[model samples]
Structures are given as C-alpha cells and as structure tokens.
Target: MSTWLFDLGNTRLKCAPLRDDGSIGEVVAIAHDDAGAWLDALPTGEVACIASVASDARRVELLDALCARFARLHRVRTEAALGPLRIAYAESAHLGVDRFLAMLGLCGAHAALVVGVGTALTVDLLDAAGRHRGGRIAPSPQLMREVLHARAAQLPAAGGEYAEFADDTDHALASGCEGAALALVERSLCAAHDLLGETPSLHLHGGGAETLRARLPAHAWTPEAVLLGLARWHVLRIA
Candidate 1:
C-alpha cells in the first residue's frame, strides 16, 4: 500500500511518498496559503502520516483534507522516547513534533546538532546514545525581516544580500538577520562540542537553511529531515 508523508510547517507544507525501503520519494512543497487548493490534487493513498507544527486551525484544515483522500490518517505527535531517541522535555507534548522528528531522523551513533531554519530557527542537540540535550527557538531571518518591516514601515520586507560590511539598507537587513542566525548556530555548535568533549556533526534543514549553506559549509544539509522522521515513526509504529 502506498503511504504518503506530510510535514506541515508554519510556512510550507511538504509531502512525499514513503518507499518500501523507508526512503522518501520526490518531495513537493507548497506554501501554506496555497496548501488547501493544492491538497485537492494529491493522489489517493492507503495511509497518510503527518507531522505538523502549524497552528491548530491550520492543522484542522489539513487533517480534514487528508481525511477525505486517505482511509487512514496518522498525525504523529511528540513522544518521550521513540526507539533510540529519548526526549529531554518533561512535557513531551510541549516540544514541537517537527523538532522531535528532526532529531529522530538525523540522530546517529554520535553527538549531532540539528538546526532547522524555517519560520523559526530551532536547534536541538542529541548525544551518541540518542538522549535529547534540549533545544532553543528564535525568529528566523525571514521572520526577523517581516517583524522589522512591520515595526518600521520604511524598511522593505525582502530583497537583501549578506555581507561582512553591508553597503546598502537591504544588504544590512539581510546581513544582520542572517548573521544573527548563523551566530546562534555557531554558538550552539561550540557549546555542543564543549559539552560532548568532541565535535558534533551539524545538520541543517528547512526552507531557510539554504541561505546558511554558504556560511555553514561544514554542516550537513538534510532538507527532508522531518518527513524522513515521519517515515521512521511509521516503521516504529508497525514494528
């Protein structure tokens, strides 16, 4: 039976088929604003598994649409422990499912830092034994720009390039916001290294992660971390 995995974030909704080998097929990303109309075109599937960090109303809308196309719909939630990974949150439900899934998807036999840059910048660290070491959340560079534009009508919402010394307002905004995010990632990596007594692998994901690729050359990029986690969740559920 064909299984579809959906990862609904604050800004985008990514969907793909889960292969027999547990790998994901081609991922299709749609803006949240266009998700409802796009869902109408989704192929029928035997099962639909989702990991959503969107608002409750948005989740309801997507769930309703998925319920229409699939006989079984599984909405994955944050868990205290899933297989090897043990969540640090005393209240697991308070942890974002997306973050939990990302860690589950990327955690390996070594310490690793998973940084997701989307509507929000999320950083989570997992040790070699799959123990959650806690995480942090901050406004993404794009969100920073939006917030700036909202507060200061004169500042443009978009259009900028990162630079050490920005010559224009646009570049300044871009550099500042991007630099802020990069700084956080760098700081986290340093702290993770100190805490683990060894350098932890850095994993980057989400829509905004690409912007940091040039700056974070050493970090491994895993765009489908959340969806991959959902696939893993499905495997664990059935096993």
Candidate 2:
C-alpha cells in the first residue's frame, strides 16, 4: 500500500499519498482547524504521519481527538531524525519543521530558494550543493495588512492578489499588501542569491502562495513545492 502523509502548515493542512518513487500524488488542502472534519471523511487508509510547525500541545490536542481513527500516527518535529537534508541553521530547533521538510522536497539536484508565504512568510535557502544554509521569517501579508489597518483607520484591507488601482487609497492598499509580501520574498531570495550566486529554482508554497505567486517574477517556480517536499521527506524517513 502507498504511504499516507500529512503536512500541517500554518493556515492549511495538506494531505496526500506518496509512491515508492520520490514523486507525490493527489494533494488535498484543508483548513488547519477543520482537520478533524477531514479525518472523519478520509478514505480507509492507514494512520497518518504528520509534519507540523505548530506546537506539540496543539498536535496533542488534535491527535487526542483523532487518534481513534488515524493509526500509526507520527508528528514530524525538529527532534525527528532527519537524515535527508543537511540542517545548517545555528538554531535549527527554532526553525519550523514544515519549512525544513519543504527544503528537502524542493531541493532536487539544484539549489532552491524555498519561500513559504502563509500565516507567516518564510524563505529558507538550500545551496546548489544541497547544503542547508539558513532562512528568515517575517509577518505574513495578511498580518502586515491587518497591522496597518489596525493602526491607521484609513488603510483598507488588502491581500497579495495583484490588481489595478483607481485612487491613492486603492493604490496604497494594493501596493501595501503586494509590496510588503514581495518585499520579504525578494529580500530573502536576494540574500540567498547573494550567497548561492546562481539562478536558483525559486519555489513558493503554503496558503498564501496563490496570492503571492503572481507578484513573483515569471522565472520563479511555485508548484506545490512544500507539499512535494513534504512528500519527499516522508519517503526518505520511512523507506
């Protein structure tokens, strides 16, 4: 039977099955809080192996509620023996496990600038040689927009979705959202590129990927990189 894999991310929980090869199949996305509903609706597969950046207590809260149905369940953590990628961060423990697994999935034969733009924006770089250099995180686009809106009553709500502007307010809203998101992405990618010094495969993932994808240069790649990477990580772990 195929392996049942789950990547519990900031805003969405991705589920899929992995073939014997490194490739993934049939990806499913669910809101993080609605994971239980998915559990009740999942096919008759084996237990789940979860990779979560969220806290252990939350995982326990979820698992305790789900353990009855999902068997052989495992949660991926920094503590999990990760033999695939070369973890190069000085504070690897502080780094999100989802980001780490993503680094693995998208690494392939080329260097990757892995960006996870969701509840929080993260850009973790792996050198062409598969060396895990390091990455950074910042408030997500939504968070940034909310912050300004909360402080200044004039700024309207906006997201990473690109749109034409009609007035200063609209322009500010559109640009503020898009600009803040792309700024973090560009900053991280530029920092990584300066060190890697090569045309890396710029891969984007997470709940915010769709909105942020458009703002990215056409040269960048964002093909469910994190999900694929998480799938790849599961294969190496159990195979």
Candidate 3:
C-alpha cells in the first residue's frame, strides 16, 4: 500500500508520494482553481494525509475530490505537543498548520529559524529541544508587489530584478519588497540568538523562497518541507 502527502496552501496544492524509505518523492503542484484538471494525473494510493491552510470552502472542495480516490484520509492538525515537538501558542489552533508542519519537518538536534515565503512571509523559531518559540508573519515580496500594484495603477505587479540600488521602478519595487522580507528574517535570527545564547540555523521554503535564497546567509532550502513534515507525522502516527 502506498501513502501520499498533500499540502494545501493559500494558492496551491502540492502532493507527493511517500517513498518506500520514508522520503518525499517527486512533488506535483497544482493551483486551486485548476484542481480538477490535475485530478486524473494525481497518484491513487491507499492513504492520503493532508495538511491544509486554505479557506473552509476550498478545503471542502479538495476533500470531496480526494474522497473519490483515496480510501482513507487523514487530516493533520497542529497539536499543542506532538511527540517531542511542542507548540508555543496558548491555543495551538491559532498557529497555521503549514507553519507548524514546516517547523516539524526540520525538528531535530539543532535549533533553527524556519522561514516560509509564499503568499505571506512567515518566520518561525524552534529550539534544539523541539520547543516552538513563537514567530512573525508579514506580506511576501510578491504579495507586496501585488498589493502595491492594486493600490497604485502605475506600479506593475510583477517582473523585476532585485538590486541594492535599482535605477528603474520595477527593480526598485522588487528590491524594496524583498529587502523588507530579508530584514525581517535577519532581525528574527538576531533575536533568536540573543534569547537562546547561540545562533540557530536558518531554513527556507515555499514558492517565493528562491527569490530570497541568493540574498541570505547560509541556509537549508527544502521546497517540499511541509510535505516532508506530513510524511514524518504519518510515520510517527503509524509507528
């Protein structure tokens, strides 16, 4: 029997098969509005474990579709504590499942500052002991551009190269927005170091991660981190 992992985010649905050795296999990303178009191509497996941060209606639609394929479905939620991992939120439900799982993916011996850049920029901190140390949320660079273009007709929503000093408006928008995200992450890292008395490693993921990876210091980049976490969660559950 095969197991599949699905990470349903604000704009996209990413799925991957849980490999025999328990690693994530090739991932397939599909937009929310194009779900039906990819249904036939989605792998049919014995179990489908999903972690969703989409709207209620969108989640229902995806679940309804999955019901036709997978015989058993597991909806993963953020728990106050799962195994050694402990969430800092007084109400664990307030933490986004995507962020919870992203941190879960990197749960290990070393402390880490996990950053997710997608529709939103999310930064989370985890100690060596798997304790959540809270996090911050802000608009991702792309989102910042979109919002700016929405409010100001003259500003273009996309297509620009990031630079320290951009001579053009497009590049300036890109530089400013992405620079803001980088600064936030760096500030968080500094704070984490002061609080923990040791600098934590940095981990980056999500669609927008590539945009900022080249600009940041040494870090681990795992695009399918959430899926990896889902796979780990499944294993822990079955074990």
Candidate 4:
C-alpha cells in the first residue's frame, strides 16, 4: 500500500507516491481532467492518502474514485500536517490547507520564502520570528505568455530551452514576458528580504518554477525545493 499526494495547481497537477516507510518513490504530473483515468492507468495498490485542490466537481469525483480504490483517503485539508510544518493561514480554516502544509517545508531559523508558481505565482513569506506575514499572487508564466501573445504583434517563439535572440519585436515580447516573470520572482524574493530586514530563504515550487529557475537570483530553490518538501511531507507522517 502507498499514499498518493497530489498537488493540483492552476494549470497542472503533480502526484507523488509515498511508501509506508516515508519514502517518496515517484513523482509525476498529468492534466487536471485526466486524474481519474490517470490513476486507473496505474497498477492498483491501496492508496493511503489523497490530496487535491483541483475543482469542486472534479475533486468530488476524484475523492470518490480514490476512496473506492483505497481504504484510507486523506485529502489534504489546510490544517492537515504536510512535509515538515504546521499550516497557519490568515483565514486559518478558510485558506486552502495545502499552502499552509507546504509552508512548513518553507520555514527555517532564517526567514522563509514559500512560493507556488503555477497558473498563478503565489509568493508567501514566513518571517524568522515564525510569523505568517501573508503573501502576494501574481500572473503565472502562462498568463504572462498569453498576455504577451495578445499584446505583441510579432513576438518570436520562446520556451524550449534558453537562447539569445535578436532584439526584434518577437524577441522583445519573449524577453519582456520571460524577463517579467523572472523579475517577478526576483522582485518578490528581494521584497521579502527587504521587508524582513534579513535575507529570506527562497523555496520555489509549482509547475512553472523550473523554467524560471535559471533566470532567478541565487536563493531560488525550484524543483529541488518542491521534491525535497514532498519527501519531507512523507517523512513527517505515515512512516
């Protein structure tokens, strides 16, 4: 039997397998609508837990399906323990519990930066004094791309690996869009540090993180941060 931990972001969904001994066996992603069928395509094993922020109807369907598939289905609630820390949303109960749980992994003796960069980029700050000082949400990489595509008349195609381009219309659009996103991360990290009056520990997660990691400043922990946090989540519980 294994637990299924799912992080459903705005544009994509990420899933991980956690063994009883607190090991993260596999991590992957799939389209949001395919969640039900996605699990059906996998080998059957008891699902110890299930977490989602997918959608109202979709969540109900997935929960029902997961419950049918496993005896225990622990849908991650805001207060639910995840990775390493307890979640404390400003609204407390109203906040999506996953953010809270994920923050636990973001916190340290130094100020912590917990960012979920998906269809929207949410940058949260946890001060060194253990304060959940709220956060901000900005356009995600996709949103930025769409904005550029709509506004720019002849922007060059970007993505599919980094490269230098002529500073033409397309290049400007691509660079501005990508640069804006990169600047958003850098800006938020710097702002967090400025507000906290100390260097904040940066931990970036969610779908768009990796694409922007190279363009970010020194503290950005994109893929590794999320993977390590997911692994930590497993160790904290069900071990």
| Candidate 3 stretches greater than 4 Å from native | none
lDDT of 4 at 123: 76
Which TM-score value belongs to model 4? 0.77
Give lDDT: candidate 1, residue 106. 87
TM-score-wise, the better of 2 and 3 is 3
Tens digits of per-residue lDDT for model 4, 25-130: 6777666554466546433346544545567776676666666667776565555334334444545676554566567656667678777766677777887765
The residue-by-residue lDDT of candidate 3 on 73-169, one tens digit each, is 9999998888668989999999999998898888899999999999999999999999999999999999999999999989999988989999999
Model 1 stretches with alpha carbons more than 4 Å out: none
- The regions of model 2 sitting more than 4 angstroms off are 32-39, 55-58, 79-84, 159-166
Which has the better TM-score: candidate 2, or candidate 4? 2
User: What lDDT would each prediction earn against the true structure?
Assistant: 0.90, 0.68, 0.90, 0.62
Question: How would you encode candidate 1's per-residue C-alpha lDDT over 1-239 as one tens digit per residue?
Answer: 99999998887789999999989999988776743675665667889998888889888888888888899998899999998999999999999999999999988798999999988999999999999999999999999999999999899999889999999999999999999999999999999888989878999998888888898849788999999899899999952
For model 3, where is the 10-residue window of minimal lDDT?
34-43
Ten contiguous residues with the weakest lDDT in model 2? 159-168
RMSD, one per candidate, in order: 1.3, 3.1, 1.3, 3.8
Candidate 4: residue 232 lDDT (0-100): 57
**Going through the candidates in order, what is the number of backbone clashes in each?**
0, 2, 0, 4
Scored against the true structure, residue 227 in model 1 reaches a CA lDDT of 90
